[model samples]
Target: MSSVANWSCTATATIWRSLGKDETGDPLGYTEPEQILCDYEGGLSKKLASLGAEIVVKNTVWTEFALAATGDYLLIGSSTEPDPVVAGADEVRQVIRYGDTFERVADDYAILTGI
Candidate 1:
């Protein structure tokens, strides 16, 4: 009967709906996930800062070729630093599919389905 409970129920319903069939006969799913790039020149950190976002630098992993083309998505959290313009840290996730372009797939979720 609390907000959390309500949110959970809502989320569950949404999930079911997303998984279920729609009137248009299209399946619901997430597009391809892309890796979050961070710790590099002109990376997500700088972008977020430019956007007036205060983020805490979290885990950083070093990857090599054959899988390093895409950088890791920087996991950032709300900043505790004092800054009026800076907003809370937002979570970012990184993912790469074996095949298929995340962009094209995103443009058409009915074409591809996976979170």
Candidate 2:
């Protein structure tokens, strides 16, 4: 299938939030992690709220964050652009064929590749 066909499904960021505990396993209405990384706070909260959970974004990072699986709520990003990458025309064309966006974050990712 063409990259565009694959991308037809849309790109999203899956976010999970940890709900504060009330001493028992139940949620205390507030989240313990206290923050989420996103490009937009209101948009993220609105999307999460639609999923029957409320999220308060404390901050946003250009890169994605991974939660440790103790999450209580979940959210998917609504971004249309793909993550950037520095690649030659062939590489870029290949990615385009898969309908994937290749964003090149301005840092040398070689060191962070394994992390």
Candidate 3:
């Protein structure tokens, strides 16, 4: 696998994982926002191709989030950006398949993808 120096750019995102539901079946809460590297691209297309689909990929931004699986929601954007793109668990998981390595970092797990 390539080193971190190979990564071109980076972005910040927010992760929201479900910690089960409350008595009313509502999600508990979301963890504080954490900054991670958005080093990869074309992940969505790669996943579709793996499924044998021939769809045209437009200006889609399939960034890589190497955070722990503890989160179920991933919002890609910077504080300056007007809006953030939210990704569900399945979408994030698909991108994670292209990760380079999986290891434990501190008290959480991390998946490093891209060059």
Judged by lDDT, which candidate is best? 3
Q: List ranges where model 3 is wrong by over 4 Å.
A: 1-9, 40-66, 80-95, 98-115
Ranking by lDDT: 3, 2, 1
Q: What is the lDDT of residue 51 in candidate 1?
A: 62
Q: Sort by TM-score, best first.
A: 3, 2, 1
Q: Tens digits of per-residue lDDT for model 2 on 1-115?
A: 2233233323333332334567677754422222333232222221244457644443222223333233233233432222211110001000001112444322110001100
What local lDDT does model 3 show for residue 6? 32
Best by TM-score: 3
Model 3 CA lDDT for position 17: 43
Name the runs in model 2 displaced over 4 angstroms.
1-10, 14-16, 30-64, 77-115
In the order shown, the candidates' Cα RMSDs to the true structure are 17.9, 16.7, 7.9
lDDT of 2: 0.26
For candidate 3, lDDT tens digit of each residue in 26-107?
7565554444544333343332446696534221223344444522444544332222222321212322324444433222
